[model samples]
Target: MVNLTRIYTRTGDAGSTRLSDMSVARKTDLRVEAYGHVDEANAVLGMAITSGGLREDVVAVLRAVSNELFDVGADLSNPLVAEPKWEPLRIPPESIDRLEAWCDEFSESLPDLVSFILPGGTPGAAYLHLARTVVRRAERAGWAAAEAYGLEVSAGDEPGGVNPLALTYLNRLSDLLFILGRVANEGVGDVLWVPGKDREPVGERARRQREKIEKAQDDLGRSS
Candidate 1:
């Protein structure tokens, strides 16, 4: 239970703040950096939720993730707890599993990719792509924070050590965002990149590609 009776506390008037463990740390601490990125990613998701052409289901998932980001920040802020019956909230396997499941579910309806894509589709998809990249930055920050504290990098789900599921959830969250971008675009119509097209003019590449397409069609017709 959180009770915020007073809004402004000048405790952090200086350049330092306290962690959930009541330990003093500078604003530039790695734990702060980690949670900062998580907050940033969540902000991006918030902006993305306002983009047009987003489905209700996709928005629902984003809203849920936005809430979980707070949990992630809290988990990072509290390094350790001495209380016997109380522990800081940590990311769980179920969260990571849900991300993976949603990613798989959305990807199943999408067409296979022949080439990498440019991060521009519908407005909603574009925002989701942006959020996906930010989430990746958050994941890297989490990893760095864990390593800096000498926490168990493999797996630790307690207050003192960085939980592997925290990193795993962020990783899977980006994956889910990437696929949800396509889902926002009706599960197709991704802006595909033309490999090696920058080496030559668009006119030249387009002519060649057109011929290749025609030739492929001809081959298919003959086989039929």
Candidate 2:
């Protein structure tokens, strides 16, 4: 089990951090960037979970995913060589398979998409869309890190490479989030985008922008 008795290590005061293996690296390393994006997606998902109006099923899946994302972070933090410690967590094929299964199960109930989906639906769906985009960015970061390292050639043969399934899991997670957006909308489905709807007069655009600005100010006022 992990212990956090000392919260202020101050080890990172020099803009460098230590990994699980006690090796030091810069804060801006690719591995750090990859895990940082995963943490961002996890935070967004957590916000989605705490908010009301989410379907019970959506909450259940996200709850499980929230846990697995930690595994993703752990896998990224610990680099693998020819042999890894028995206790270190590694994202396996089964984890990715579970995500694929969930996507398959949820997708069956959703209607086929005829138009592009805007990030507007229920409160849960909007947060899910935000999470999906963030996960895509995480996937890209993982790919860049993999390039800096190398892709898996054989089991534990690729030195210092991340678990390949971690990348696959993030890819499937974004797909599942898109499907969940449709599920959150229920019978209403996603808000379809009409291509030419925004080609109105400049005055109309200004009016919408003004409303957006007012809404932002009103939100700040409420918090204050």
Candidate 3:
């Protein structure tokens, strides 16, 4: 039961903040950065949810992800200890499995990907793509934190490490967001990538001129 009597605590005004374990750490700490990115990704997910035009099923999935993101943040914020005074909220492996299942469910109808996709489509889908990228960043930050702290389960009265499953959850969430984006773009179709389509040769003359220059340079190098 968490209650926020006041929104502003002014304690972090000095560039320091407390972790879930009540230990003080700099605002730029890797652990702080991991959860901070998770918060950022969650905010983008909120934007996607409110952008409208999403189907009820998609909205339901986004809502669930938003709530689960809080759990991820809690897991990241609370430092692991060998023997904590109480059990802490940790990201469970089953969450990743759920994300995988969602990905499969949503992707089943999407057309085969011949080329890479550009992010734009429906408003909700664009936002989902943005959220997906942010989630990738969160995953990277979480891994960095894990590298810094190590992944040893705390046993006694000792400092514990970040949950590896939490990092995996971020990774799987990103994939699900991508599939959801495609689902949101149903009927409109995905904005497929056309490699060099925008940068095609100006003309045959221009292409020939460039090739001539390259050949001349190669020949000159060989002669020299």
Candidate 4:
């Protein structure tokens, strides 16, 4: 069970804050940036989920992603002042394995990538793709912070470093999101694949081609 408290504390009026260890720092600290990105990613994922039409499996994966993101945020919010009395948060390798498995399973259900896809399908799936891109950016920021921390440690300035596994998890998570977007819109009739300007317009040639492809897919779906 969890305890709930709603009392407001007016501690942030000075643009500074306390970490989990009760150490004070500016809100614009790199640690804050790292955690802020994780929070942004989580919010985007929430938007994707609420946009609707996601499969139960996809929702489950997103839920897991949300939980893991919170862990990432918690890990970033506190920098080691001294070797803490408690264990530091880390992204385990098993989390990466789960992401890979889910990506593979979802990708198996999608058609082979013949052309570069424009990210649109269902609204939920489209937002998932957008969130995936944002997650990649966040992962890059996290890695940069980790590298800086490593340099600090190497210089004998600190005793702790960023979790390598967390970076790996974010990398795999982006891949999983791409596959999920593809699978989520499978067989949905409104999928519109935009052609390059060099390609023919939506006249007889394009219409005929689209009809042939969609017909083949419809037949395949019915047969299956």
**Residue 145 in model 2: lDDT:** 84
Clashing pairs in 4: none
lDDT of 2 at 36: 92
Q: Which stretches of model 3 miss by more than 4 angstroms?
A: 155-158, 197-224
* Local accuracy of candidate 4 as per-residue lDDT tens digits, 103-194: 88877756655345557767987888888888898788877777666522222346356666777878898899888877666646324454
The TM-score leader among the candidates is 3
Q: Which ranges of candidate 1 are over 4 A from the true structure?
A: 80-85, 153-159, 196-224
Which model is ahead, 1 or 3, in terms of lDDT? 3
Compute each candidate's TM-score over C-alphas.
0.82, 0.82, 0.86, 0.78
RMSD (Cα, Å) of model 1: 5.6
lDDT comparison, 2 vs 3, better candidate: 3
Q: lDDT, candidate 1, residue 66?
A: 96
lDDT of 2 at 127: 92
lDDT of 3: 0.84
Q: Against the true structure, candidate 4 has what lDDT? A: 0.73
lDDT tens per residue, model 2, 32-93: 89989999999999988887678898899999999999999888877766555555677889
**Best lDDT goes to which candidate?**
3
lDDT of each: 0.77, 0.79, 0.84, 0.73
User: How far off is residue 108 in model 3, in Å?
Assistant: 0.9
Worst 10 residues of 3 by lDDT: 215-224
Per-residue alpha-carbon lDDT of candidate 1 for residues 1-224, written as tens digits (9 for 90 to 100): 78999988998889899877677889988888888999999988988898666888888999999999999888888775345235678888888888888988888867665556568757888888998998899889878878777464323444355666778888899889988876776633666565565424469767677566445434433432
> Which lDDT tens digits does candidate 3 get at residues 1-224?
99999999999999999988787889999999999999999999899988989999999999999999999999998878877767889988888899999988888766566557779868998999999999999999999989988788777655679988899999999999988887887746776654453235577866665565445434433432
